[model samples]
Target: ISVWTTLAALLGGMLAADVVLGVTPAYFFAALPRAVAISNLWLALGKSMVFGLSIALIGCHYGLRVKPNTESLGQGTTASVVTAITVVLLVDAVFAVVFKNVGL
Candidate 1:
């Protein structure tokens, strides 16, 4: 779902930009392959997948740690949210460093 949504947003934005710039669909399609390489596309998809997986795992882990009390539930939820954000940022930083010259 995340991959599909990202692709949709990417293509939609590209199409909108082309239309606004008075570029035809044919020209847009022709330029797209050269505009973004396959490796870059795969990198984006892989990052999204990792982010999604980390978030899901964190949520599930904290969720199971929750007790029957409301307090535990609230604390578990807060911890999960905070941890997920932190993990995503760290993962993104790692990716940036690792792929610094990927498209260069």
Candidate 2:
């Protein structure tokens, strides 16, 4: 899921950049690799994978804690989504801090 999501995001972003900035596809593709460090790319992929896994696990955890009531189920799902988003943001901030010296 992460791989596909990443691919779609990259493709969409590239296409949008091209349209907005008048950058040709060939030039964009050519400059992409040179513009980004390999380590940074790997770090992004790792973060995405971790975020996906963490969200899934956290969602399951909250989901299983739901009581046998409609209110509890809605509350659990809402909490799961909110917590997952917060966790991802916090993790991203941590990565930004940790990679501050790495030129990420």
Q: All candidates' TM-scores?
A: 0.90, 0.76
lDDT of 2: 0.86
| Candidate models: Cα lDDT each | 0.89, 0.86
64-102: candidate 2 lDDT, tens digit per residue = 899999999999999999999999999999988888776
Residues forming the 10-long window of minimal summed lDDT in candidate 2: 95-104
**Top-TM-score structure, candidate number:** 1
Query: In model 1, which runs have C-alpha deviations exceeding 4 angstroms?
Result: none
Candidate 1 clash pair list: none
What residue pairs clash in candidate 2, if any at all?
none
lDDT of 1 by residue, 24-45 (tens): 7777778877887778878988
Instruction: Please give the clash total of every predicted structure, in order.
Output: 0, 0
